[model samples]
Target: MKEALKSFFGLDDESDDDELLSKNLNDDIAIDPDFVMSTDMLLAAIMEAYRVMDRDKDALDLFLTKYEHMHENESLRLMSEKKKKDPSLSSMHSSKEEDKQRLVQSANEALRTFFKMNNDEDARLLFRSLNDSSRTAETYIIMVGGLVEKEPWSGEISQLYQSAVQSKCLTEELAFLAMKSVVFSKLDGKMRVLRDIIADTSSVLNISPEEFNSSRYWQLKRTLGYRFAKLLMWWRNLSSSWEKELKLSVRQLKQGRQGGHVIDEDALRCIVKFAGHNQRDDINQGVPVSDGPSEKDQVIQNKERKYGIKLIREVVVDAHQTTLYNSPAFVDDVAIGFCSLKAYDECIKFVKEMHSRDLIKLKQSTYEHAIYAAEEKKDLKMVDELIRNMEDGCSLNIK
Candidate 1:
């Protein structure tokens, strides 16, 4: 056994480095394969030795080329034939299954070691090279979990997730990890990442919506959609370029929902807030002209503002008509959106519908918007009603 260790590391007993090598190969011990030793155990020891020596890629390569093939169907078949003669061969069949599990465990250990060494390229390559049978979901999860923890802000993690999706190896847990990592990362192009996740989740649901219709799954989609919409707000400026981009974002949201990516209430809230801002910008445009915007620019702002108001009304009406998530917060944003465009009547009507559903506990800002909208419409009765509404559980701070 000592001689095997020496030979494994290209050493000999006559070498002067015996004491140092002894300390390094501490895991190597005398074992009888007939009693307890297995290929996985030996491979693990060698891989650990390789990792300690900073040659983890070699360990991965060894696992890929040799230890993974420990599951030999022909050997199992021969053993089955032998079992006909001797009942003792049943243990051999069980050992074969155990060896397969050990091989998977060994693969996981190698992957974790590669990640520990910061040799992500080799880890990625090793995972990709694995056949479908060898690549268990746990193996994939461990690889991605290591990557995310080691480098949470890396775009490479997102790419690895995409590759897993293409290979059909990305489980729901993996998808959740990838989504969270991407969101937490300071990486650019987050909207694109969200879109990718939406598409991936949609694919899974398309197969068996009933079976896979988990709350956690829908929650992930809702979180992604909300974030995507929040990011869209940065392009809310009335500049020509940003206007086009914002329009594209809105269209993407629509198309996503149409394509089976559920746009939940949280996402609609952000869109409502965005539309409110657009309407406010339009209101600012209508104020006394300055040397700031050209006549053509004012015309464009008016068109975009109209589009924004139209969007908010559509969203509010859709929420009311459909049995969707109509939280009080979402309804608050809807009220503010209508008031921003001085659409007092529409705002009040929607508020009443939501109030009837017990979803209209207005926040301070929404209360202020309602007050201002009623005043703008010269409706004293409406203003008094808003004051009464504020007296009942609504904050009355009008800024």
Candidate 2:
């Protein structure tokens, strides 16, 4: 039987019985008889068996059995050392408090970088990472200070201000500085938020009148008052209550004898004119009626006294010369007041000069009045010369 087996298996002719027995022993335990077994595969098989059997002690025993032989390899030695140091393998949990502290420190460093760069995305991420409220406040202080100093991203300044207000993470000094910066930027949204904050602080903290009057506080107050007045004047088409508030606020502003702050006179005049024009005498008492020879009327009277007769003569001459000849409102206003009382030649010359500059398109009524004045003058020759000059000098579509 042994001779038949040796012929079938291709065994060496000189192989001893012990060698044959050892070969048979390995074959019986082999996982894959067709494949060659490696040292790693054998180790893996032992470890997997121990795992399936829930035999941690066996796993340790098997690992120890092979470790000494594998430890001589540098990669194997390093891997074994790493496994020993691993907390999960050693039944230990790392200190989460220490980990949190490390994370916060990392977040703060990132925040500092964000402030320097003014990278909004990075700043936002750093702010989100901060778990400590005090640290969050400090981070925002640096950010706000940098923003104020640099004025980077001016368009987004309002958004940043809103974020700061919502966070409520700024100190009073920081908030004051932010408010002042908003004024400098002239951002309406930031200004509105600042006003609300000031009003709320005054209401909540019971801040004294003396404190409100302090140099720093009053500077802020004055800024608010002046800005409110300007807003009122510039945004005049707003609701009546808004206009009233603006007037009251402006009156409350600590103005010198001349005026409070550098008021935009153009804006103020437009606001006053708009209000006067829209005033309802029925609803309001003692509304000043603009009568003849009043301040407004005096302005008209002065212009009439100065340029009225001269403008009339020019319009009459221009009307006779060309069908396209038209006079502007200022010229017509002057002509209407004095055309009958003055000569035609002077009025035609004045109208010609005004037409050259293109400043006379004041109103349609003023134009009609000038035409009437020309018809009344009875100076057809002067009117014809005026029209010829206007047709040659001004656009033919003048009316």
Clashing pairs in 1: none
**Alpha carbon lDDT of residue 54, candidate 2?**
49
Q: Evaluated with lDDT, which candidate comes out highest?
A: 1
Per TM-score, the best of the predicted structures is 1
User: To one decimal, what is the Cα RMSD in angstroms of model 1 from the true structure?
Assistant: 13.1
Instruction: Give the whole-model CA lDDT for all candidates, comma-separated.
Output: 0.59, 0.42
What TM-score would each prediction reach against the true structure?
0.46, 0.28
Query: What TM-score should be assigned to candidate 2?
Result: 0.28
Prediction RMSDs, each to the true structure: 13.1, 26.6
Candidate 2: worst-modelled 10 consecutive residues by lDDT: 278-287
Candidate 2: tens digits of C-alpha lDDT, residues 263-291: 22222222222222222121122122233
Q: After superposition, how far is residue 243 of candidate 2 from its true place, in Å?
A: 27
Cα shift from native, residue 151, model 1 (Å)? 5.4
